[model samples]
Target chain A: MLKIENVTVKSEDKVILENFHLEIQPGEIHALMGQNGAGKSTIAKVLLRDSHYDVQGMISFHNKDLLAMNTTDVAREGMFLVMQNPIEIAGVSNAELLRTALNDRGKNTGNILEFHRELTEYCKRLELPTSFVHRDVNFNMSGGEKKKNELLHLWMLKPNFLILDEIDSGLDVDSLKLVARSLVEYYEAYHPSILVITHQKTLLDILKPQFVHVLKDKHIIKSGDFSLAEQIFQDGFGASTMRNGETNE
Target chain B: MNRIIVEQEEVFLQDESVFFTEIPNSLVLHVKGNVCLALTSIHHMEVYLEKGSHFLLEAFVFMKNQTSKIVFHNEDDVVLDFHLSCLYEGENTLEVNSLVDKERVRNYIRVRSVERFGSLLIKATGEILENTRDAFYLEDIQSLTTHQERVKIIPNLLVSSNEAICNHNATITHVREEELFYLRGLGIEEEKATQLIKDGFLKSILQIEEIKK
Candidate 1:
């Protein structure tokens, strides 16, 4: 339910992405693989309208003009980006941030008791401590804990469009499994569209994306099925991108 | 554990936890045991800790076009834990001086993030007298303001003791853009996001949580 066409993004007078294009139908999972500085994460930032980049393109979400809207509006329209590194907020508790967001999105947060129960249940499901609800957002958590904390927000906000940027990075084996399973459960429950940007095969082996696209030279170069991801992991991006000479068409 | 009005003389406090809403005109304090003071506002004040004392002070300052100087004198076996949080709007100057003149004295001064709107000049000086054995001192000042040029922090450390340990740090920064992006990406408006970040920074003063960078 998302379409991006002929998008060119530039930051600080430097061209980062040139005519980048990708599209995803409803309930489809797409994996984007790229090497360092291939502009894979730039796509997510541009889609969220970071305003640092000079963007020229047309992006539509559910037939709505995505590029015209601001970051908050894009988020309000069911778009979410799990950043590569979650920032630490010193005193803002997760509960407060979540509650404010839920209320701003017109969700019924009036039932305080129900809200507390839902948060507690989510914590238990995610294997996080119940005290994390009141703790500051990613204040002093480990790498694994920070990822789980982002997942907690994921479950609470319930965004239908998720751009997973290195969601598996810095995760231990067990936390990776937990995160993968939680994502699977969320997908099964809501069937949201996912554009996962990753290099590892562990998460892809579980999520099993329907489409896999390789990014190079500021644009997507190849589009394949889950096998492409396995092939890239088995070999490398240099070898995999060379195999498919055709651009994503 | 008691709240008493400070007279213009030496008040010896033993095992007392006090909350000073406003600093009196003048006074000298002596702590016999562990003592704590939570001051909401401060002015031109001088505090002296007699020999063999422990003190912890948390002060919050919100000022506009005001100047304040606070001096502290520490004696032998005296420990001082000082935390100051400032929010300046128009213009202000705050200077804090701590004198560790005796043996085995420890001083910790933390100027928690100074939120500035117009201008602010913050100076923190730590002086360790000569021949003092095992004198430890540290001062850290941080400022968060969009007007980086308007906010200035001068951390001065003067130590004459050869066996003393003294350290100072200073930082000035504006609201982090990446942080705002993360918050706005969660559907919170920009205005609300900025406010939340500012509020969190100020309130973090009272919390002793470790930050994992």
Candidate 2:
């Protein structure tokens, strides 16, 4: 369960997000649709406590003050954000990072052999090579491979809450289907809460979020079921949004 | 592929290794064959590579109270790949002079130095003589230091051959904040994350994979 109440985020002297609010219950998947630069990804960054932004108002994750927690603590508290553009870090292998992260969270990975087996299995399921385990994190990888690599981390970390920021972008049709199917399977197994930010109806068609919220003017202006997403797909965000007493006119 | 322990003051190396063997004070070596050489515990050393030989040199340096220099002489068709990893905590100057007067030679030098205290001065020079055709040389150096500890990198490429290719680059940086944020976002603590970044930096700068094998 996560709650955002009248959250205001600012960068330097400029305000990037104002009076933004959303709430997600356990096992609920919410799709946040917005135009370009409508502060959708800003919410994800602010939730992860990216030090660049100045945040105000209240954000509670599992009834704890989320804004007070640092990025590491937020991750330890079962919060994971898959950024639109994953960073490329050279020389730090994926296995090394995953092991360190699990150890820091006080989660034992059983034994070395078991951990290697599990990681290799995940790589196979994701259609990535086993050698990726030793390769640097996201370095020199293709765009589609970077997306799948994030999903690999998702499987490894197994967080309770996920903020998926444009995970479907740069993925082929088959890769998108694979990613969506993986998310559905994860949902069925763990019943984790998810916030998916996207403009693609194909991803929404597969995951089938319970609610759809359109972000505009720095806050959620409309909330509806999957039909709203379908309506936007048929028309556009402008036709679906009611801005300034008009349909986003 | 032969391993050699440097017991004498001078030796001729042809397919022999001196890894984990500290040189006594100083030594002179005539090198041949394709080899991975690690110069250890030597304040001053001289190396002569045979014509048409390939050599890979790796060294992780930590010294105090004295300076160190390694001078290299290259014959025709010789290939030299040098990786120098340095950790400095006191005033030290390390110089690597590669003298080349040969045709169809390649010399690549990479230096990675981290200054935790005091200061470090790295001078890497590649001198190519005239009429040396089809020669190429690269000098890349990266250093990390805080405000109190200073690091200076000097890459000297004195090439007299018009038909030679030469490149020199140097980068000095402190710990980057964005990289730290990325690691911390994955639940790694700040201190450990910093250490990981530094370790990664050191590992990547080596660029000599076959040497480890």
**Best candidate, lDDT:** 1
For model 2, residues A137-227, the per-residue Cα lDDT tens digits are 8888988899999888889989999999999999999999888888888889899999999989899999999999999888889898999
Which candidate should be chosen as best, given DockQ against the real structure? 1
Q: TM-score per candidate, in order?
A: 0.87, 0.86
Q: Model 2 over residues B92-147: C-alpha lDDT tens digits? A: 88888988787888988877876655788888899988968898889888887654
Please give the DockQ score of every candidate, comma-separated: 0.72, 0.66
Badly placed stretches (over 4 Å) of model 2 are A243-249, B15-20, B32-36, B39-42, B50-54, B60-67, B74-79, B87-92, B100-106, B114-119, B127-136, B144-150, B158-165, B173-178, B205-213
lDDT score at residue A224, model 1, on the 0-100 scale:
93
User: Candidate 2 clashing pairs?
Assistant: none
Model 1 Cα lDDT, one tens digit per residue, A1-249:
899999889999899988788999999999999998899889999888898989988889989998889999999999999988899998899999999899888998999999999999999999999999998999999999999999999999999999999999999999999999999999999999999999888999999999999998888888899989988998888678963665445
lDDT of 1: 0.86
What C-alpha lDDT values do all the predictions have? 0.86, 0.84
**Cand. 2 Cα-lDDT:** 0.84
Tens-place lDDT per residue, model 1, B1-213, is: 455555455566677788765456455665666778777776777787878888888778787788888899888898988888888778888999998778999998888755545788999888877868898898988887766789888888888889898999898878898989999999999878877887788777557523411
Minimal lDDT window, size 10, model 1 chain A:
A240-249
Clashing pairs in 1: B1-B17
